[model samples]
Structure formats: structure tokens, C-alpha cells
Target: MKCIVGLGNPGKRYKDTRHNVGFMAIDELIRRNHWELDKSKFNGNYTVEHIGNEKVILLQPQTFMNLSGESIKPLMNYYNIDVEDVLVIYDDLDLPAGKIRLRQKGGHGGHNGIRSTIDHLGTKEFKRIRIGVGRPVKPIPVVDYVLGNFSEEEQADIAISIKNSADACEMWLKKPFLEVMNEYNS
Candidate 1:
């Protein structure tokens, strides 16, 4: 089984924020596949289902955004899953809204949640599906902007991106990464 983790903070206050895009994608996947996210003792919620022959664990870390690894590591250790099978879904301030990038490995690129996952996992060699949230035109407080709600103009694009992200997750679960990138990222 593979663990596909959507990193974000919990609660309604963060429900529609840019930082919670990961959560949004998970919501889409569950809605599309009729998967149930039941609470577990691992400081997160998980759902089990099959994507072809592969059993997937859909996860939403409850350790909040910053300390996401705290929830991820325990479940991974318990399942004894390889670091390579972990797929991380997160927001990317580097790309435009509605854009999605699927990469095999790289740096955290200043995302604290991703950084924590890398630290806990001891490698950056896992799959990452980064959905663009875009950057502010003028400089703004990082935390404020990331945790902030989307503007009216950004709403449509964000909605499109969330669905596209779910598609990307499904592609990753089925096809090889390079083929998924060729089909989706291009």
C-alpha cells in the first residue's frame, strides 16, 4: 500500500485557505472515489481503498501544518512503508494558481510542512504533488498570506486546481511518475 498524504492544518478556520489546498485535494479524491476518512490513533485520519491492484492510504495529518511529520512518521513506521511510496500533496507559492507540478524529489522550497516531512523521512526522494497557490504581488507576511483565504478572482482557478490535483493523485496511484508527469504536468 502507498500512503498519499495531504499536509495541512485542521479545523474549519483553515478550511478554504491556500495552505489548506492539500486538504482540499484530499476532499476531492474522497468525494470522487467514495472513500471514508475515519479518525485513527495515529494523530491523523486515514482511509483505505484500492486503486487498481494497489491499496492506498489517504491521509490528512492532524499534527497541523508545521509539525506534519509528527503524524506521518508514526504511521509510516507502523506500516513499514518505504519512503519512496509516500506521496505528499502541498501548496506551492512558486507557481501560478491552478498549476500543478509533480516531482520525484527535491528541496522543501520554503514550505515548512514539506520541510518537516523531509526531516522526519530523512530524504527528499519521495513523490510530491505541488499545487500552485501563487505569491503576493507586494511582500506580505508569509504566515498571514499562506493562512489567508483566497480572493474572489482566485476562487475559480483554485477550484480548478483542486480538481486537477485530484486527477494528478489518481494518475500517480496508477501510472509511473514520468508518465504521469508527461500526461498531467505538460
Candidate 2:
């Protein structure tokens, strides 16, 4: 089994914020598969579905960003999924807006969501897909910038990135993750 987790703060208030790009990508995947996150448990909303013979779980932790692991770890344990079979999607401030990067393992890079995940999972070896929202060009605080909505100029790029992220996820169910990374990382 494989688990795909999207990190974000839940509720309508954060729906369109830059920090919620991970949720956006997951929404795109749910749309494509005609799936709904109908089950709620372990502080997350999730769905179990088969994708080309692979049993996959799509999860959106309702525990908010900084406490994302509070939701992920329990669900993973309940499903008997290993660290290697988990893929976490979240926003990244280091890369330019709309850019996406995939990695087999890495540090949290100061992301509290990832930090919590690492702490709860007791490992830093899970896969990740980072959707870049870019750093604030203005003098605003980092938190404010991440919580803010994207500018009009970034809308197109954001849309493309979300689409690409969803596509890559579907591809992962069929092909090797390395191949999907090579194909999308370009």
C-alpha cells in the first residue's frame, strides 16, 4: 500500500493561500480520479482506492500544518504502511513560484509541518514533493507571506504546477518513482 499526504491547514480560511498548495495538488488528484476524502480518522480526511492494482490512500491532515504528523503517523500505522511507501506533498519557500521538486529523502528545511512529520515518524527517509510558492519579495514576515494568497502574476504558474503535481502522482502508481522524478524534475 502507498500513502500520499498533503500538508496544509484545514478550513476555508486557508483554502487559497500559498501555504495550501499541497492541498491544491491533492485536490487535483482527487478530481482526476473521481474520488472523495469521505473518511475522517486519525485527525485526517482520507480515502482508500485502487489505482491500477495498487491500493493507495490519499490523505489531507486536518491537524493543521505545524501538527501534520499528528495526523499522518497514526493513519500510516493503522494502515501498516512503511516510511518508503509514503509521499508527502507540501509547499516550499526556497524555490521560485510554481516550481516543483521531488526527493526520496531530506531534512525539513525549517518547515514546521515536515519537522513534525520527521519527529513523529522517527525518520527522514520518506519521499516528498515540494511545490514552491517562492519567498516574499516584499519586507513582510515569512508567515504572513506564506499565508497570503498568490498574486495574479503567479496564478498561471501555480495552476500549471498543480496539474504537473497531480500528473506525477498518477504516474507514480504505475512507473517507478525514480522515473517519475526524472520525467517531472526537468
Candidate 3:
């Protein structure tokens, strides 16, 4: 079994925010897989589906962005899941728009959600699917950049990135992590 977390705030106002890209990708996965995220479990909306013999839980932690680990740790404990079996999909500021990266584990790279996950997990050894939303033209407050909604041009690229992220999550569930990293992380 594995736990897949899509990091984002919960609300209509944040629906189109760059930081909410994680939620958008999960939306794609749900639609593509024809799964319902209606149930409240593991501190968020989730559904268990069979990916081959594996039982995978698709979770969108309602604990919000920075406090996501609070939701994750409890679920992990309840299910007795290893840290490696966890996959976190979130927006990446450093990467360009439509760009994607998949890493097994590392430092947070200034992402509060990622930093929180690492802190609670007690290790930087988990799977992550980093989707790019690109950076603003001029330097701005990190909080504002992440929390703000996307522009028209940004939305176009983000749509593509979200689809690819959903596909990558499916691929990760169906195959080895290296397969996804090699094919999509370039």
C-alpha cells in the first residue's frame, strides 16, 4: 500500500493558485481513473484504488499547505506505511512552467510544505513529484507568489503540467520510480 499526497489549501479561492497545482493534478488523476474523492479519510479527501496488486490511497490533505505533514504523519501511522511508499506531488518555483521533476528524496528547496514533510518524516527519503508553475517576472514575496492565482498565460502551461503530473503519478504507481524520473524529469 502507498499514500499519495497532493499538497494544497482547501477552498474555492485557492482553486487556481499556483500552489494549488497539486490539487489540480489530483483532480486529473481522479477523472482519468474514474475514482471518487468524496470520502473523508486520513485528514483529507481520499480513495483507495487498485493499481495492480498494490492498494494505493490518493490523498489531498485538508490540513493545508505548510501543515500538510500533520495530516500525513497520522495517516502513515494508522496504515503502518513506510516513508518510501509515500508520494508527494506539489508545485515547484525553481523549475520553469510546464517543466516537471521526480526525485526520490532531498532537501525542501525552501518550500514550506516540503520542509514540513521532511521535518515530520524525520528523513528526506520519500518520493516527490515536483510540478513547475514557474516564477514571477519580478521578485515578489514567496508567499504571495505561491498563494496567488495564475495568469491567463500561466494557466495554459499549468493545464499541460497538471495532465503530465497525473500521468506521471499513474506511471509511478504502475512502474519503477526511475522509469518516470528518466522519462519525465529531463
Candidate 4:
């Protein structure tokens, strides 16, 4: 079994913010798969479904961005899931809008959600899918930038990125992470 955890703050207030892109990708995945996330457990919402004969769990952490691990760790523990079988999806400021990158493992790179996951999981060996939200062009504070909504043009790009990120998640279910990375990273 593999678990895909999307990191973001919960509630409608943050539903469309830049920091919630992870949630957006997960939303896309849920929609494309027609999976019903009607169940609640492990400090978030989740649903299990088979994809290409593999049981896959889709999770959206409700512990908010900084406390993401609080949701992920418990679920992983209950399911006996290995770090290698987990794919964390979140936003990245290092790349431009509409871009995505996958990695086998790495440090959080200043993302509160990833940092929290690393802390709770006790390892950075898990896989990750990063959707590029881009850094602020001017002098806005990082917090403000990440929590802010996208511009009209950026909204279009982010919509595409969200769909592509979901596609990357589907690819990971059937292919090796490295293979998916090679195919999607550029």
C-alpha cells in the first residue's frame, strides 16, 4: 500500500491560498479518481482506493500546515507504511508557477509542512512532489506571499500545475519514483 499525503492548512479560509496548493493537487487527484473522501480519521480526511491493482490512500492533513506530521505520522503508523511508500505533495518557492518536481528524499527547504512531516516521520527518506508557486517578485514577506492568493494569470498556471501534480501522483502508483521524476521533472 502507498500513502499520498498533501500538506496544507485546513478550512475554507485557506482553501485557495498559495500555501494550499498541496491540497489543490490532492483535490484534483480525488476528482480524477472519483474517490469519495467521506471518511475522517488520522487528523485529516482520507480515502482508500485501488489504482492499477495497488491500494492507495489519499490524505489531506487537517492539522494545518505547520503541524502536518501530526496527521501523517499516525496514519502511516496505523497502516504500517514505510517512508519509501509515502509521497508528500506540497508547494515550492524555488520554481516558477505551473512547474512540478519529484524527489526521493530531501530536507524541508523552509516549508513548515515538510519540516513538520520530517519531524513526525523521523526520516526524510520519503518521496515528495513539489508544485512550484514561485517566490514573491517584490519585497513581500514570505508568509504573506505564501498565504496570499494567486493573480489571475497565475491562477491559470496553478490550475494546470495541480492537474499535472495529480498525474504525477498517478504515475508514482504504477512506476518507480525516479522514472516518474525523469518523465515529469522537466
For each candidate, give its TM-score against the true structure. 0.96, 0.98, 0.95, 0.97
* After superposition, candidate 3 runs with Cα above 4 Å error: none
Residue pairs with clashing backbones, model 4: none
lDDT of 3 at 130: 92
Tell me each candidate's RMSD, in Å, in order.
Answer: 1.1, 0.6, 1.2, 0.8
Ranking by lDDT: 2, 4, 1, 3
Backbone clash tally for model 1?
0
Error of 1 at 54 (Å): 1.3
lDDT of 2 by residue, 27-67 (tens): 99999889999999999999999999899999999999999
Question: What tens-digit string does per-residue lDDT give for candidate 1 at 81-123?
Answer: 8888888999999989888888989999999999999899889
Query: lDDT tens string, model 4, 1-186?
Result: 999988888898889999999999889988887887776998999998899889999999899899999999999999899889999999999989989888999999999899999999999999998999999999999999999999898988999999888998998889988999999986
Query: What lDDT does model 2 reach?
Result: 0.94
Provide the overall lDDT of each model, using Cα atoms, as 2-decimal numbers.
0.89, 0.94, 0.87, 0.91
Better candidate by TM-score, 1 or 3:
1
Candidate number achieving the greatest TM-score relative to the actual structure: 2
Where does model 2 exceed 4 Å of error? none
Predicted candidate 2, C-alpha RMSD: 0.6
Q: Which pairs, if any, clash in model 2?
A: none
* Candidate maximizing lDDT: 2
